[model samples]
Target: MLGDDRGQSNLDFLFGISVFLLTFLYAVTFIPGMFTPYQPGAIDLSAVAYRTSAMLAEDPGWCNSTAAGGLPGNSSWEDHQDCLLRIGLAGDRGHPNILSLNKIKALESLVASDYTLVREKMGLNGSIIYDINVAVEMNGTSLINAPWPSASSQNIESIERVVLIDTGKELFVDCNNPGEQYNSNMLNVTLNNLTSRDRDITIRIYNLTAAYPIGLAQDPIRVVSLSGNAISLPPDDYIIKLNGEVKNSTDFGFMKGDVLEITILNTAISDPIISAVNIWANSSCMPGRPVDYVYDPVFKQKSVCYPGIMRVEVWSYAFS
Candidate 1:
């Protein structure tokens, strides 16, 4: 009896060992497959569904409008009319990268292809609103109009244009232009031009609250400086100095009703030559209603249903 009991105990121990060994081997093999970099919903021969349900769950508003059919069927005149204005203003302009209404529509279409609406809210003001956020790569492209050739004799171009934090403060003007000139002796021309016009070439930053002043010096909130083509300003939080004095962020913040004026003055010549000015801001801040409501026009009026204010922040850099 004692021998039989001992034999039974030994058999039970072996069985336990075998079960553990099988489980260990199975785990070692299965874990690697589970952790494979390929997504489970990826197009594999074994995958029954090629489309991922999670992709469908994302918000459709996040899609790229240009990639999708022009406009969604549900869009209203107010929603789609602004696009018409953008296209009109940008039509065949040398700069192809400006954000036009067509581009906005394309963005919407791209969003629809990958995502579906989960929830949306209608504001009291009769605006259809969304709280959707989408993750996208920063392609390092400017959404605003690209700076054109300097209308002035001196060539200055604005680079790294981006909208900073939204403050309700109004802006008068924000403009950036890059310019260049060719001469028989490139090195001599560059050196002589720099020496002569270095002090006269002033970049004037302004925050205009009323109509954009037709002349440069007529603006109210303005900061002027004379420097080389590239100028780097020191970093100070919440305060931006225009001349030598510190001022409020609202004085320079990019906001609704605010404008940025970039004036490049070529002092080398008898009369200082001023370059062209570029304008940008939420269209809602414009003083008057959209001029024309046709399928295409230069300016489109947008309702400030979401963000009620415009904010501007300026940073200066020197290019090589």
Candidate 2:
């Protein structure tokens, strides 16, 4: 009877050991799949790409407040990296996603000099780094392609932002008619009552070949006014008189004679920031390069504005 009891006890002990081994094997099989964390880096990478795209498309950007020898805002931001606090392309001061050509150029210059600076400015840090690519597309073709040096085999995470480009268009006015004459050399351009929608209007006065008269050759000048009044400029420069007071520009030189070309340019106009372009001219229309004015091939006779789509692209390979 004692031997039988011992045998029964041994059998029970073996059964218990077998059950424990089976359970242990089952748990070990699933340890890698169930106990280990999934790839969390993917979520982080996707978030970073979206955040960068938003910053470029939405932020109006900021300049260094302390004046570290850098030009502040607009076209002046080009070439002065120390001055830029943020990088944005939007134009409408209040609107996001609208691109500004001036700001685009500024950022292009900045990134070209050092792409790492962009990542730092974007608040990216730690072991993860990124490769960024910015591009502008129109009609399925790339207009502007800016990218950092990156390997093609590296996994890339990319995002795109749609944007509108601010461009210039050519405008022609016939001052030969006596009624259109503001003076013998100047023509009257009615402001079209563009209250809030006013653009940066540029007026260039020259001859048939687009030559500025001898004494009137000078860079384009900005003039603004609300009521008709005489804003005197130097002799030998173009004359453009607007209703609003000039906000930011120097007075150009103009000469008194038969006017050839009277071009008016206005940018997206808003209160407290009215901008206009005025050039001086006379009958001679001699060709000369003004510090401010340069010939653009887009226009055959004079300067004009053209609209384009700005395509901004970003790429990251750290976790992608």
Which candidate achieves the best TM-score against the true structure? 2
Best by lDDT: 2
lDDT of 2 by residue, 23-91 (tens): 999988977566433744433555667787787777766665444445645422333467666666665
Q: Please report the TM-score between candidate 1 and the true structure.
A: 0.20
TM-score of every candidate: 0.20, 0.45
Q: How accurate locally, in lDDT, is each candidate? A: 0.26, 0.48
Q: Which regions in candidate 1 have their CA more than 4 angstroms from the true location? A: 1-21, 24-133, 137-320
Q: Write the per-residue lDDT of candidate 1 for residues 1-320, one digit (tens) a residue.
A: 45544345788999999999999999999998775648542222112111111121111222223423666432222234322211111112333222233333333443354222221211101122112222211234222232211223222222221212111111221222112221111011111223233222222233333354222111222212233332222222112334434443323444323333222223322223212112223222322211121121322222111111111111111101
For each of the candidates, the C-alpha root-mean-square deviation to the true structure, in angstroms, is 21.4, 14.5
Instruction: Quote the RMSD, in angstroms, for model 1.
Output: 21.4
Worst 10-residue stretch by lDDT in candidate 2?
290-299
